[model samples]
Target: MKMLLLRYSTAFICAVFIITGAVSGEDKAVGQTVSFRPDKIVTPVSSIIWKHRSSTGSVVKAIEWDVDDGDNIPNPRFKGITTLDQKTGEITITKLTVEHSGVYTIDINSKEHEQRFTLNVMERVPKPEITIEESSNPDVVYLRCAYSEKIIWKKSSGETLNGMKNQDPGEFITVKNTRNPENFYTCTLKNAVSEEISDPVTERELFGTGEDKAVGQTVSFRPDKIVPPVSSIIWKHRSSTGSVIKVIEWDAEDGDNIPNPRFKGITTLDEKTGEITITKLTVEHSGVYTIDINGKEHEQRFTLTVMERVSKPKMTIEVSSNPDVVYLRCAYSEKIIWKNSSGETLEGKKNHELGEFITVENTGNPENFYTCTLKNAVSEEISDPVSEREIFRTGEDKAVGQTVSFRPDKIVTPVSSIIWKHRSSTGSVVKAIEWDVDDGDNIPNPRFKGITTLDRKTGQITITNLIIEHSGVYTIDINSKEQEQRFTLTVMERVPKPKMTIEVSSNPDVAYLRCAYNEMIIWKNSSGETLNGTKNHDPGEYIMVKNTRNPENFYTCTLKNAVSEEISDPVTEREIFGTGSNAGMIVAIVIVVFIVIAVIAIVLSYLIMKTVHESVNNICPCIPNIFGPLDCLLKKTDREPKNSAPNDVASPLNETAP
Candidate 1:
């Protein structure tokens, strides 16, 4: 791992000496906070030292180290404006105000523990401005808001018009006289890294009549500025479509107090005075009301603008009948509007019917999300951006080493342009094979020079050798007017069958089965029973099992990677460890040896008895006594071997290696 150094803090240590005893000052931006702290501090510090290059000529070590005290300087600029951490020996200027922009020095009573800092505080760029560039007609207006790190456009009612949150200039919104006055907008200026100033561009357009009110507040349409006669107060309503409607009529002398049927239940009127009050106001009650005096030519008009709180709009995405097209449907009893990622209106309407949905063709921008904002004649509601569901994917499971392939599910005729891309955080890199509208395309994106192949006819891509870095979503955007789509591809490595070896312990009744594989290993018997393996933090390779005299005890090992698996051949316990039956085998061998010796002795005796019998007459008569028992065996041997002795005799026993 790499280490992050405190270069900023270390530089401050050097700056303290340069400001008091040496010369020179460093520069800093105007709106950024500057802080310096020594890595180590000496305990029981005797004195606190502070000096500014221009304000103090000599070092001032006057203030004593205390938890409750701050800088003691002749210059009033930093007296109460700075904080000192007595234990850490760190000095922080809470904010870089204009008065604190200068070289500063601090010391822990000696030259060895001194620190310094310089502030050149650069000025902020400027508050954001929205310049209206009207087109040929007042209906079409182009607005440019800038002079800030980020530009956000919202209607005067706090409804954001665009979804751009970048450092780039904002996109213009066209007014359609539904959700807004349509052409009027306000922009918020934000400097993400600056230390001061967050302002909305109220001068661009008027959201309300400079009088803002929250929901659930009582509103009055009383004409306190101009008081008319009690008998001449007649209240009338003006519709947004340039029509006049009656509200309530009050004639004090005639005792005639009549109210419109729509406001009969909600409107409260003081009969003694000509004042009308609505208990609760909603968006439906937003309009202009006029109170006229019967005999006098005096009239008072109240734009009784009311606001209501609305819930977040609901949106649904579906794959259209055409595989390449998608439908996004959102509904609100109030007004509904939609904007693309770039802050441009894609599909929207102020009064969308209950069952009607919106259809949109996807754009080639790296971002894939769209927003649905709910609004009324008064206030606007915000919702999180939603992305299209990845309904189609290439059946490629990602891994370390494997081949991945993908193709579009549908194709349109007369294809003019195609944008092939790989998803990334910064932005999707376009690897299109065709970009021109009328003419065809060649290879783009140098990163895929020889690593990928694409079929121009069907837009199918086959990547030859895949690595783990290639594991992500791949997208394709066809003809300019069509919807953009994507397919996910995953790469994986192959794992070969592991080698299984059975090992025997000092005791002949125990054996262990081991496997040699990288990712994972498992040991089992022929009956598919899993043997208890040694617990290892990494991949475990060994498992113990009972070793018996029977040779049928065998183990099987299986190895696996994320995407592939392999199984090993069965190994028997007897193959690794001996059966412990060697003693019995030795006894059988000794019995066979004794039988051979007895047979040889009997054959020799029989031969002598036969010889003596044949020559009894030539020799003595006592030969029968010396070979008496052998004579009987000789008779039996004669029947066993018709031919005296075969030249080559087959062995009676066959021996095998253990």
Candidate 2:
């Protein structure tokens, strides 16, 4: 019974243990615990705890965690929670604040264990206030980004800003604080899990005054007030359209080096002294020049101007004879002052003055030199001296009948008129033909009545139909003062008839002969006979023969005087018709043969007519007088006496006619 009671107790105790183990295994499968800190910031040597728990009753292995804060985080630190373990089972946060308070979770396999913690860390350091020193200086301005604790400066546009710990009260945040009105700056202070932001600070830049001037003008630009330590001063130019033309860069200690396109190779800049010089200024170099002092822009404009020069004057003179009749002309551009060699001033019409042309007349001189002085308002000039000795002897000559001619040494505009006079036998000046022609003129004496022809362009004269009474010694004068030339005139009687002779032909078979009296065919003859071969008889016929084959003969022409009845013989040899010795005989034989043939043809024709008439009479015996004698002869047959023929026949038969 004792062994039985012991076994039952052991079974009951083992059952209780099994139930507990099953419940614990279920808890380990369903529950989780995540470890994290409540606050991250604390003084050095402060108690830092590593706390963790598990949801299941199973014993859990304890693991350590890492810590980080604003000093170790990347730029732009913020208050937030970050997991220390890759499994996100533990978390360590810096500068904890309400922003760092959140529920953290730990993941185990596929299960999550979470814990909500309120981080109560110390407040983060306050952001320092920012201020700009020398905000109105055109050269440079100071910008300060400050905070109560170590703060990081940043640009609103995400630019990493340089920072200095415990900067002086007025020290600038950026090394070269070139201020731009458009830049937005801010400062942020961060502690463990806590951060503070400061309002943005901007540096106000003062713009420099601008001016424009001509390129050659002196330019001087100085600041309104001296700068302390004199930071970098730069010069820049802005174009008329508000664009950057050039940037003037200069070191405060070394000075400036400014380059401009207009001043390329022609301008120099001083690096030790900020001085710019441009030699040989040109108008094209006009533009705006800018000076940039520490990124401050100032500008000035330049302009330029220019002028022209003057020229000299010229003069010419023309002199003429016959002072009272012809005119003298002088031409000049500037104002002219005429003076004679005798220190006498000559006055005349001031024809034209305005640099166009001028003419003066009647300035007569015998031995004086004429000086023409042309003067302008600024200067006075004189032409080369013209002497009267050059005009003492007029360059003109005259002759009677021959043309009176005048030729000047030089061609002068506005020609001078030529004057002419003529003297008669009485030694008195008389006007006969006082008219002007081209190249010459005709001025005949009053007593001269002959026809005179003058060619003015050629200076030629011709006189026609002169009478004995018109003969005389005539003198022709030119230009009045020039000497005259004398010429004697004589008239003659009429012309007589010319002597002449007639020519005749010695051979009868050759050409005809004729005579001309003063080129007039007065008489003509052929062969040796003359049948009324005189002017009174037209188409006179004598003995003439045509040489059909050859011609070789001599002709004799006798001319009888109309008053003396005397005959004059002039002979001419007939030309041979052909090159042969018996040319005359051949011609005569050919003529004779032609005549005989013609006579025989005529006789044969007459015989035929007689036969035809007889035949007609025989055919019609009743027709009266149809045959006349020819028919009558035909009617008488052989029985009729041969003397019974007509007596006009002059034949034996005609004498024997009844």
Best by lDDT: 1
- Tens digit of per-residue lDDT, candidate 2, span 1-658: 5469668877987987755543211111111222353222322321122222323322222222333321122212232333344333345544333322222333333333232332233444655666665645344545665444556778754666776545453224542333233345777766554467678754322222332333344344444443344455554444435565553455666654545565455455544444455554544433345444455543432211211111333444444453323223446544556676778666646565443322333233334566666654234566666554343333121222332222223322332333333443466665444333354444556443456544433223345554444434444333333333333333322222322332335654455443343222233333555444434343322223345432333333333321122233433333423333355666898999999999677546546787754554443334445234445455655454443344543233223335
Best by TM-score: 1
Give candidate 1's total backbone clashes. Answer: 14
lDDT of 1 by residue, 156-180 (tens): 5556676433355554555432323
Q: Provide the lDDT at 314 for model 1.
A: 65
Q: Write down the TM-score for model 1.
A: 0.31
CA RMSD per model (angstroms): 38.3, 59.1
Tell how far residue 160 is off in model 2, in angstroms.
0.7
